[model samples]
Structures are given as structure tokens and as C-alpha cells.
Target: MPEGYEDVCAEQAVVEGGLLGVKVGGEPVVLSRVGGQIYAIGGICTHKPASLEEGTIEGGSVRCPRHGGCFDIRTGEAVRPPATRAVPTYEVKVEGGRVLVGRRAG
Candidate 1:
């Protein structure tokens, strides 16, 4: 984990279509609750700087609002075209109503 950083309580209810964007380590991180687990990924779409928070959250994936690219929220894998590269994904854990994201392990 990065120094001087910790988990932040984003939301209690992670409905099927709920999405939350948070700033961590000076970077925008998108947190989506799917199947009762929190998945953290890069908030910005790889195809553009468009915020994923404004995108659609459905079928356990987030679609880029600017370009129509799709990505799996759990794995951060590109699921559709217009975005060939995959975004960064983080490990998330929930404790005491707080959502904690660990540093990307090497």
C-alpha cells in the first residue's frame, strides 16, 4: 500500500446500477459495487479522459460515455472496441463500512 493513504468509506449501498468515483493517491479511482463486492478501477476511460462515473453501469461492467467502450469493473479488462488497452485495477476490501483499496500488487 502507498504511504499516508488509507481506505475511504464511499457508500453503504452498492446497488446493481450504483457507481462512485473517488480520488486516491492523487488519481481518480472508480469504485463500483457489484454482487456485494467493491471493484476499483481507473476512473478515466482509456479511449479518452471521460469520467467513467458519468458512464453506464450495467451487466457488471462500465461503458465509456465518450466513446462507447466497455470494461469489466471486476477485472478492468476491455470488453469492447475503441479501447484496446486495459485500465489499471486495484484490490478492494470492505471493513467497518469503509472501502479499502490496496496497492496494485506486482
Candidate 2:
């Protein structure tokens, strides 16, 4: 496990092509499973005050439900219009069926 990592939820909680919302280190984060991998990113959309948990998963990207802005789940990069800023990405690892989230990636 990496330093600053905290268990967020069970690895099974994040289904394939689905999104799960969780709080890590007192900060809101959204978890998604894509292509058998779990990714963690800031929960709120950069384009507006919207929860990424409510958004839909499109391939390797998450589409914000508020304005349809899309963000890459792997890199936290804004891949669509209405969102010019990238969301914060977090380090995630699965250990013993638990999903652990670490400090934000830079």
C-alpha cells in the first residue's frame, strides 16, 4: 500500500462501467471501474457544481450529468466541451478486496 492511502470501500462495490461516490481523507471522490481497473477522481464536475457519481460512464470517460461534460476516468482530463479544467486524480489500489485510495496524483 502507498503512503496516505485509506480504505474507501470494497473492490466489488465499484462495478464494471459503473461509478461510486466516496469520501477520502475528508474530500469527496468518485470511483469508477473501467476495463477491469478502478479509478479515483474528484467527485465534482469542473464545468459546474455537479456530482460525478450521478454521471454516466462512456468508455474510458465519465459524462457529467449536469452539462454533459466528459472526463477521462484514467487521467482526470477533460475530454469534452463545457469542461476546460481537469479534475484531480487519486492513486487507487485494491488489496484484499478493499479499495484503498491514496493521495491525489500530480
> Which residue pairs show backbone clashes in model 2?
none
lDDT of 2 by residue, 1-106 (tens): 6679999999989999999999998988999999899999999999988999999999999999999999999999999989999999999989999999999993
RMSD of each: 2.4, 0.9
- Per-candidate TM equals 0.86, 0.96
Candidate 2: lDDT over CA atoms? 0.94
Local distance difference test values of all predictions, in order: 0.78, 0.94
The superposed Cα distance between candidate 2 and the true structure at residue 21, in angstroms, equals 0.1
- Candidate 1: tens digits of C-alpha lDDT, residues 1-106: 3454467564585555677888767788888877877788888998878999888886888999899999999788889989877888887777666777777531
Task: Show the colliding residue pairs in model 1.
Answer: none
Model 2 residue runs over 4 Å out of place are none
